[model samples]
Target: MIQETLGHLLPELELDPHTVSALLCASAAAVAALNWMQRRRIQKKMEEARRMRDLGLQCMEKAVQRFKQQNPGADPSRILSLPLVELAEKLKEGSLSAESVLYTYVDKALAVTRELNCLRHVIPECEGQLRDLQGQKEKGLLHGVPVSIKDHIGYKGHLSTCGFAPFLGPPEQENSVLVQVLKHQGAIPFAITNVPQSLFNYDCSNAIFGQTLNPWDHRKSPGGSSGGEGALIAAGGSILGFGSDLGGSIRLPSSFCGLCGLKPTVTGAIGPMAQDVGGLALCMRALLGDALFQLDPTVPPIPFNEKLFCASTPLRIGYYETDGYFLLPPCMRRAVRETGELLQEAGHTVSPAVPTSCSEAASLLSPAAAALQGCIVFMVAQDLVDPGLKPQVNCYRIPVLVKKILALLVRPLVSPSSGQLQVFYGSLPTLSPQAYRTEFIAKWKKLQLDVVLCPVLGPAFTLGYPGKLLAAVSSTMLYNVLDFPAGVVPVTTVTEADEEELLHYRGHYDDAWDRRLRKVRAVGLPVAVQCVALPWQEELCLRFMKEVETLACERKKCT
Candidate 1:
């Protein structure tokens, strides 16, 4: 009788409650099965990582415990102190062999690994890699350079787990295109670094390889995705490293770790097709230029334009103190303002500039949507992500109707800036990438600016805090949204004074970011400024970055 009545009603109403209930139940069961499989996969992957980590620890401990004599002529300190360019020059001149350089870095890396937990996979094949370079007649472009790779990038026979549990199994059969290019240029990638689970969050902690701490302060994260590279470089374990940046991954970590990182703008001129390319092709396009498309015919055949890098005269510099969304803390704003002043003092024309639609882009990239969906999808399809992200994932999964009801029923009784409402609104995202870029470029060119100075998402905050400040990413995410070349230069360290200024911050909005700013106490952390240039202007970007670095370096030395 119920079936007959339902059939008649379904034909009449275009829907049946019983059929809808049945479909929902089936969908729920399928999702549950997916979740179960994912959990099992993660457990296995976790065990694999744990065993490897233990092995790495034991090897490192044994090396330290044994009285191993240092190379009679190798001064690890002098070797470590030379700039990468000078070291490459020395290697080319035959003063340094690739082997010695490799060992020095390996030893340095092992020592620091115990403290930071930055490396996810230490290449046990280091000896094999060194051997291949032994008899080369001419030193390659990166001869003797020891490079660290982000874990997500592939290398032959190494699993690029990407910090996802179900992503385990099958080590890659071939090197990522970028890795191949680096090797062809004589760079030896000796280690793969850690990343946050899902590579979405800023904190460099994951359930697979554990947390990577800031070398400057244990209380803080090293910044993430490319976070391990940041920590390793900051700890002096590697002279150079490669990392991917979506928004601020490379630049933020570089800022927090007090190192220089270049995020070359994706231009059509000369780079192996970059935008939307993932895994190895992106890195190759970034460092080697688009000339490598011969190796990858799928790549956009653009070559790196060498001429655009030159700034023949002083640049017209544009500077901004905030992203018009999250107002920066005093230290972060000071870094940008000071850098602008220094450029002006050096005879560059400095003026105010802003990205008109960046905030709208940031809204589109709201973490509540991207991060929550990523975590949930990863949670349901593969292994669940980190426990730290559980709260966010759970909240995002709440039905939109439920959220609206909560806003109506619960918001009036709670604080206006409640997390629930903010999350709900932010989860409703909208993006127009191509349109935003077109508008941004037109506005930027009208300003006639060679480079723009800004902050790297405020100063590195305490660990566990950045995830909460996802909205604060407008400062860095704007450039990413624009796909302009950008770099980070550390300008100052936090002083006791900077921490107290938050209590009295009177610049802009007095919202939750302000409240969180007031509670932050991350003194001694490095403050960094980001230098940005229009697409394909990496050379100019690097030069401006150098100017900031030189000024900052000289000032610190004098003090």
Candidate 2:
């Protein structure tokens, strides 16, 4: 096609065949030369990253060895096993030295990342921070706790690459406000974990830092952009870490990794991830302290509400087994079912409360909301020039009429479980925002619900599934659109029964997506449910999560 076009156009321009051939050859040669130079530059950057990573690993190893030599009989396993609150207590009471705890976690983090490829850089300044912290008379809420942070959250003298090659450059001169607040709380930031390129994708892989694998099953993704923090913490590398979430970045990873995570209503809010709800609560309390607000005035100065978090009054709870759009896997539905039953058993007034379809709500609430997804993909494509995101990029690049026609062509091939038609229908909003919000809030007021329970996603999806199944994120996207404070709690693990049930699964729409979701090899992976509350009620969200965590534990014991 190119040759034919050039042949006709060249004749019109009065160009000869020989001259055209010469020009084409020269252009090809220049392109090849540029490609070679670009490849060479990429290689150099990759090598520098490798060297930095190696040096960081070596420093961590030497620090671990030094600690072992100093505390010959120390039981690092015991220290590593302690929950965040317990560990903090131990450190504050002097029962466990801060150095000993730091080294123990560092040693474990080294092992975890080697297997999972989660960590990007180990903070070498931790030892110095420890020394300074010990000299202080006051012990903060997180005194001496070793914490991990997601890749984009800045630390001094370290590159905040966000898994993109071009971002590999001079290290940050000063710590970001989040890191400074952590340090002020006496927490040591030991490492910065990996992220998907540009912090946009749900899968935790990129051109520069490679991929982060699930700790539960390497065949599956750990979930992103907080995937590294989830994998590392789930593997017992770090007890407490911070991950930012706008959609389900924090909660999805936590659900996949069998950890607890929270996402606040604040835009681009950074939240806590840990093995238990208590850890998240503790971290949330510290993050909401005066230190954070004072350090960054943009933060709402609302201190953590102890009364809301500590209240034992039974909540009027709303629960749903599935969102209207996606066909949730059997395990996901089971998690919601069992969690609601447990919450009911615990005396919370659990009632059926299925809100409007997420896509519908998004259309009514924000007409150009779907464009945000496209915009994010475009930014990632621009930043990385990486091929992993090319499929999504290409989809967005196509004309809208073409996309609609393609969707129509594939409608017959899709199963009913995919709800493809509903998705399109939802895109065309019929109700006003006031009408929709009023109706939803009426259900809320009628139920007098304190929190709502739902599924986070289908399950810990198989590796490479997220990129193909972007629509599945609609389950969590609704809460994000509404700016609700949401949290995830592990209710149970996928059982043999759940896998058997999947064989007969027919999603809400019996399309390729539903079939693919059914085919995911997810037996034995952890299943979790989302807990959501009104905007700025993060403490209440955490409190509801804590209650669910307690009930889940008791149910496990009884089983």
Candidate 3:
């Protein structure tokens, strides 16, 4: 019976018995050869990576030891105490040399990078750059300043993989606009930091460089896709760093890591010397100049006004704690409230405002935009993801088919709840082009609050929980949809009393989300809030943020 069955199935198998045996043998040999080749390649790559990592680590260790040896009485607290602006001033007046400043920061940054996995590549070339800049007669504002950039921002002749391994050999022939600007201003690009695989998610995890942890708390996340920049800056590794934001990439990381970041109004700060993709260039032009400038060059150029940063009066501030979809985590809620109170105390008019359903708008806009763009996001993700996560990648690649099969098979047994269904459904929409585009456009239009203040997410949850609160990202994505400038300010830490308040809370929206909230409450996380300004109103946003920071300082002093 077995022989007869095999004979019947043999025709469908498309090989004669002898041929199949021979083919199998050949395939086995081929697979063995391929495996050997792969093993050799992996071993070579690992050896190179190890050498680079070890060299960086050893150099940093020596630098730190030498610094301490030279200045035995130097205050260790100086590492964490001084802000970058003051450090820059000190470096300018001959009080600090380029060597001393760079050594100190490089030492600190390298140490932090080792601890947090924040760096993709550290440039030994920076030491030379610093020495050369110091010898120059004319020094720019950022002269001798050490700055780290996000990996996505290209640096000439340096590896610009943007966290993908395939692009890891050397720098680009031309620098990105921001990089060129930084170099022109005497900012040394010493290192490039890690990013999310697709530069989309808030969690800073990639297979190439791994995860970057929060400097304040190791087990928690530092925001992403500019997360490494946030961690490095906060850890006192770099006096100043450059980060790009689309959604809450820059602001979220800055907030999580307790550092200040500025996301300039679209094109208000762009320079012409660097290369930019058309969409970004267009976006920048739209925000900085006239929309008609796209068609006609005869339009007057609208340069970035320096006066915007030095505005005398505080502007009207609009604030909210939650945006209906998800409640603010205590830390984020406190940050927003404290910021609002501070602005009010500082004599800025503060008004409570509720933002409309921006998440719904984002949900609507994603489908249509994704469809129109021909699923570029998916393709980018596929290209960047590590082979180790191939299964996860496949789910995203064929989301509709895979999700339906998953829903029919796995979901029923594993996640029978409606909430789980919603979560599952969220992943499936990426597969539908028209659905993604329609959702994206509608979502964009729906989030129309004029300078809204909201939470970046719930309170600072631990590292592994970012996916759980993915929906909460709607707060940040709303501004991304509107192309507005949003800034995050750290307000306060979670207190025992805050935990107590949460203990008795009942589920308001749904039992599942409420349970997630309660789990978050148990963590005792820090709180921060986002203050968003209309496009090109970054100055106003910063002014409001300063007021909020002041209030937070006062509250701390009182406590």
Q: Number of the top candidate by lDDT?
A: 2
Give candidate 2 regions above 4 Å deviation. 1-14, 362-388, 404-439
Candidate 2 lDDT, 480-559, residue by residue in tens: 76668899999889889999999998877666677778788687889999999987898899999999999999988998
What digit string (tens of lDDT, one per residue) describes model 3 on residues 516-557? 667654344456677767665655565555556667778889
- Candidate 2 vs candidate 3: which has greater TM-score? 2
Per-model TM-score versus the true fold:
0.83, 0.92, 0.77
Off by over 4 Å in 1: 1-41, 56-70, 267-286, 289-291, 297-312, 366-376, 380-384, 400-431, 506-508
Q: What overall lDDT goes with each candidate model?
A: 0.70, 0.82, 0.61
Report the C-alpha displacement of residue 524, candidate 1, in angstroms: 1.8
Q: What value does the lDDT take at residue 489 in candidate 2?
A: 91
Ranking by TM-score: 2, 1, 3
Model 3, which residues run further than 4 Å from truth?
1-6, 9-43, 60-80, 267-307, 312-314, 368-395, 401-450, 501-517, 521-525
Better of 2 and 3 by lDDT: 2
Error of 2 at 300 (Å): 2.4
Q: Model 2 residue 283 lDDT?
A: 87
Model 1 residue 465 distance off true place after TM-score fit, in angstroms: 1.3
